[model samples]
Target: MAADRGARLGFGLAASVLAADVATKAAIVAWVEYGARHEWLPILNIVHVLNRGAAFSFLHDAGGWQRFFFIAIALAASVFLAILMRRPGSSQPERMAFGLILGGALANMFDRIGRGAVVDWIDFHWGAHHWPAFNVADIGITVGAALIVFHELFGRRRVSEVNG
Candidate 1:
């Protein structure tokens, strides 16, 4: 029963993240012209850019094969995450982490299928340096990965202490 409840919670969170990611990307496409940038703050800008490759735009200019490659990876990751979320031993945090990663992967996969690239808009910069532009899907993936790392570092220790 706990496992079932955890699955439901994970699925629900995944759905919410997916919905938000899709909506935000759609809005960016509709409102921001391709290659155009709008200053949002001293350190931020809203822009429309298409990434045809993996994170940090790796292989973005490597012809066009990277698109399908990334889609395949996302699909694989989504399947793995779904399986992890359904594991009976998975705690709530672990389930949530898997859900977030699954949602982000699915969102990016859909973009690769429908748009031929991932739409990135959020930009952060300081002076002459700039961070790679990313979207909501990236946020979910990053945060989820961080959560998993945090749990691995601290959660296990706490559990062991309690058992002792």
Candidate 2:
């Protein structure tokens, strides 16, 4: 009973986050266009940019090959994450981390495969220094990665104290 509830919690978080990511991307596509910039802060702006490749825009201009490569990579990642989630004794935090990563990856993968690119909008810049434009799924993966680190650090401390 408890295990079922735990699984649901992880899956629920994943579904919500993934849906939010996809919906936000759809909104961005509906509203923003390439090179159209809207400033939210002196250092932050929303400018639609479609990423046709992987992280750091790798192979962004590989004609059409990048599409298949990226889709395959995302599929592989999702499968790997599912296996990790099913591992015996996986804790809630671990599951949540995997869920976030999987959801985010799948969201972007769907866009890349269906649209041939991923929509990116949030832009950060400071005095000519710029960070890559990214969308909600990117944010999800980043936050999820941070949470994994948090879990590893604090989770270990708690376990040691309890067993000590």
The most accurate candidate by lDDT is 1
Query: Which runs of model 1 end up more than 4 angstroms from their true locations?
Result: none
Clashing pairs for predicted structure model 1, backbone only: none
- Alpha-carbon runs more than 4 Å astray in model 2: none
Give RMSD to native, each candidate.
Answer: 0.9, 1.7
Give the CA lDDT, 0 to 100, for residue 96 in model 2: 82
TM-score of each: 0.97, 0.90
Q: Lowest-lDDT window of 10 residues in candidate 2?
A: 1-10
The TM-score leader among the candidates is 1
Candidate 1 lDDT (Cα, whole model)? 0.92
Give residue 32's lDDT in candidate 1 (0 to 100).
94
Candidate lDDT values, in order: 0.92, 0.83
